[model samples]
Target chain A: MGIISKGEWIAKDIQYRIFEQPGKFDQILSSERQLSVEYEVSRNTIRNAITILENREIIQRDGKEYRLLPTKEDFETLEIMGKQSWRTQNNVVLDTSFETNKVQSQELMQPLGTNVRKVSYIRTLADSNTPIGIETAVLPTKALDDETVANLHYQSILLFVGKQFSEAFSEEYQQVNLEHADEKMAQLLKVHRGEVVVDRHSLFVSKDNSIFVELKSSILPRFSVIVQPDQDINTKVDGFVE
Target chain B: MNNEFKAPLYIQIESLIENKIVGQEYLPGERLPGERELASTYGVNRMTVKRAINNLVSRGFLIRKQGSGTYVKSHGVGDKYYFDLAFTNEQSNAGISELLAKNGIKVSNQILGREMIVRSHFLAKKLGLSADDEIFGLHRVRNIDNEPFAVEYNYLPGSLFANAMEIDFQTIGLYDYMNSKGAQPRHVYQRIQTLRAMEKEATLLQVDKGDWLYLIQYQSADQEGRLVEYTESFLNPEKVNLKFTVVKPSI
Candidate 1:
């Protein structure tokens, strides 16, 4: 994978337009005359690049005109598992409870012998009082100041923690599964006892290699979970164990 | 009337029919039982059955042919919902075709064309190459069990894969060829999104207009961080389910 030549680069640029913004250009630089003028490349270079793109099926020669190929839709729905900020969507919080306790080894990658703040709450749909989900969030107490922790009543704790720490943190790990609701969970979710539910667990890690928060959510069967990984980061986990 | 039931009779009837359609009890373009027959089967009035049928028709599940009976609408290929939770590590190195083959699924490729080209500005920046550098481009359509599922476009550095243009991609997997060339990809970056089929895509994929597709852009590099290949693949969403796991590094 050494350095590529200029013609290949231009060829890729044209291909990107077809995929990222299809049909924007009726036909990519319809003629060799337009290609040389727009791309500021020699005739030979433009011809080579266009041939490359043609070979890739990014563009096709329709008679005399070269038309860009149609691809899939461009719009994207992104859902970052753990790093997403908690916001109410047509749902009202029924109750909230906060407590402070020693950090458990299971909760953090390595217990720092420090206390953590735990926030738990239940939410229901606005139209009907039917429960939707329950969330439990745990954050290191030492990482935040007293003011930030006090204001965590009904706001997004991830945002609050982000503002407190200078280093950036992102969702590092997430696991989603279907599980039967226990008696207490069923009571909160208003579902039949032992009904199937969506359970998700996530861990957010800071840039400096600290697991700052752990979140667990149990959602009713009516809801669907969408997880979109961050594209910019190299999120490939080696030896991925389910 | 049973007051304990949460849903009304008409709504429950609608769901029953819808489930049958989804479960393939009634196939696409298959005519459904008459409204009177449905009413007697459900012990409901003709109006209730009519309403249930109307609901499905409006939702695109059923269609009423003029002067004929109601029929399940043909949703084209890949209508059945099947999801695959694909692990990136396994997919990136092994290639999707090989992965599917291992699962007892037949994978085939139709090579559209191959040619040598000079780098464009975007490709130059992406592959860390000079604008004038030569590269090889390959276009192909990938199918499973003889059904077209994905269209693939691949770009490889000519300096490393000068003989790429000579290989017959229709019979040989691209990754296998790369591995043979001692350029097996070690790292990969990918972006996945849901997209609607454009006209050309719809025709190539044999899907109707506006069918949902899974678009995956993949870039891979060797151990030394030299860009090996970049690919854009459009997949039929209905036939595939993608799943990946992310883990935090130990401190």
Candidate 2:
């Protein structure tokens, strides 16, 4: 959660690589030339990263080659994980608004006539200001505390809830499909009507399966849903019986 | 599977329709015959037919309109899954063929081409090989029930898998082949994204040009921590559903 420089991020990536490919990756750490080629970084950057690693005792200077040592498991999430981890990415929200109403009919995992809050926003790149995605989030009104409900403006609902309830949060069951751009979506996304867009629907549920949040996103073709099936879940389900 | 005695006629009729749906005899969104017609077809009474239809509707296999009767519910091509080909027999990384066969669906693959070539600069950087090293490229299209849904290309180090030029890819999975050579793909890094299909891809996947495709790119490392393979697979989204269940790592 701390802001890290590029060299620090690369250092964390090197540590993760060593853990992932435990016995073999240490050989790459033997020399600066090998480390630079292995990570596709400049020799100077690799030098900076190696100094950080050595100071942390992740690796030690031996007679000819570096020796691997024990260190705490601390790594950058986005650098180690290829393709953006949707939940962890720093999304800049733009043109956000909120509306509250009572549910008229039965909702997914919600009973009829529950009070709910809805927010619609466009996500933009901080540097480019180009619209990348549009998202709509809906949640029960009671899920929020008074401070969050009172000061609601343009903010990320996921980040808000994630900061508050980090322990119980488990994200990411996603369904990706294609949808034609509607008039409102076309104007917001700057795409012609009827053009194809990637539609993603996701759910963030609690580990105890109590709280649930539904997120629906419409993104340009530049974005795609990444799925790395958890081996633990695969074993638990035993090949998805349903 | 406890069948001590004969169940009721309606329940048996319910399972009969269920099997037909699962077996793909009655396709998704295809209407079932009317109750009167079905009762006569099965030599049953109208009430019995009505009960069977009612059971299927509640079980989510069939939908009933006011006047149109019942139709098979479409669960997006109904289990014609283009699943992960990264398989190991011991770990149960089940491939497409095993999964489809488990569901009683037929699976087949057509080998497009399998050739050996010298490594390029890109391959050398990724696989950590010297220039002029040999690499194997295998191309195939995966079909379920004779309908093509996925097109794939797998690249492997020929120095490690010299028999790649001779092994029949249709008979064994790419990961299984690697395991047979004493190398196990124990760690993998994959990226999933969407792309618009171009002319060649559109034709191969049977989708119109500009249609969206699910592009999956993977690099796998063997048990010895040597990067062994890189695969690129394009799947027609309409024909297959990619469902993901992700567990969040604690920060």
Candidate 3:
């Protein structure tokens, strides 16, 4: 690309801000005024830049405030793949060998509503020969009724539920956090009390609205999240040793 | 607004200034408000403002001299990140060189090999060159703290980057100079994978042969959507980590 023209540069900056800070337009300068000032350029230049963002569905001008347009499900899927790749690159691991004391039915709050069922296989992921994540996945008996689903291993849960039984798994949601591992979790992961670790609770669902599986991956806190707008990523793989 | 993660303060400050430029609050060629004034306005120390402005200067965002006041520099073709790091170094104690510095990484460049060969059918299509046309192959190793972290091999159509042989392998960022010469990167695509390091890579990264590594191959294109640069980054499994944020529908 040639040198960025004053107008184009201004536009790119606005687009980046809108993506980075979802709803700061009111407190910050509008893309329009910003373009006029910096480039000694026209408001239309800013509008054109914003138009491109609108086309991508990153943001929508709502009354006076520009609201962020939520990304489609593919973003989360790609994001997980990236994180898993990074952790593998870093060689951090989670030990998933902790045995379960009991397998019982329990009720938990879910987005769709309250659901009750037996959850199984509390697992952990490890890196550098140390555990970094602990996961206790709950599955509704109805969802796991088939013998095939029941016999599946931890690694094949998403695949069996997604590709084989239900519709193709294409959507995911995740909450990332940095905090100390709780006592129980700390014991399972074998980390010191109050040590910071990366926590990512992710859920994958099918187009038919079935909850395929949930994965909770943890890592050492030195990692970060880098979000780039307008990129498409497919497939998911998790590992510690690259 | 800076994303409220515990990112370094200097990065936050730099982004703030970048925002002002984007907002047109600081127009091109226009002098920024005085350091004291900006410090007071931003509620930061004057030294902080100095650092920020110095970074802008190195980034081609601002121009300065010993006696004369600072002014915005016009965008010129050159390594943008190189100048960016130069300016960033002026402000914060660590500077933009933080990426490599924090990891205690040092780079040693060796032109492993170079050759002129005909472009393959696949490569020819990507570079807009004839399938049988000649291109230069440049291979180099990047070391971190005396250990190799990545080996890069590049293919360039000889017609482009003709003075390619003159590149000071030990110094200078390729893209920065290309940008100055009017080569800018407008888009990039990348694919990442996890694999075991081979004997050659194991020797370079100083790890066992069976150890793992992250492989990233990326292609960058110009504004006209023409392919310009292709790169491969092989990361040592022990030293580096990657981060990516995924967004999707709420369902």
TM-score of each: 0.46, 0.59, 0.38
Task: Indicate whether candidate 2 or candidate 3 has the larger DockQ.
Answer: 2
Highest lDDT, which number?
2
Give per-residue CA lDDT, model 3, range B122-201, as digits (tens): 34443556768766556666765556666665566666666766777556555554555454544444444444565555
What's the lDDT for residue A166 in model 3? Answer: 40
Model 1: fraction of native contacts: 0.12
Candidate 1 is graded, for docking, as incorrect
Instruction: Give the whole-model CA lDDT for all candidates, comma-separated.
Output: 0.62, 0.63, 0.48
Q: Write the per-residue lDDT of candidate 1 for residues B1-251, one digit (tens) a residue.
A: 56675788889999988867775446554578889999999999999999988999999999886766787776755433222233334235677766555433558898877777674645544565776997687878888777888888788888999888789899998989998988877666665544457666678788986665666666777766677877778777556544344542233
Query: Candidate 2 DockQ score?
Result: 0.18
Listing candidates in order, what is each one's chain A TM-score? 0.49, 0.48, 0.39
Between candidates 2 and 3, name the one with more favorable TM-score: 2
Per-residue alpha-carbon lDDT of candidate 2 for residues A1-242, written as tens digits (9 for 90 to 100) = 11223465577667655755668855657678877887787999888787666644567678766787643211112212322223222233432334432222223344446555666666655456666668777766667654664333323455566555556765555556777899988888788898777776666677775566677778776543454543422333222111
**lDDT, residue B25, model 2:** 48
Q: C-alpha displacement of A197 in model 3, angstroms?
A: 16
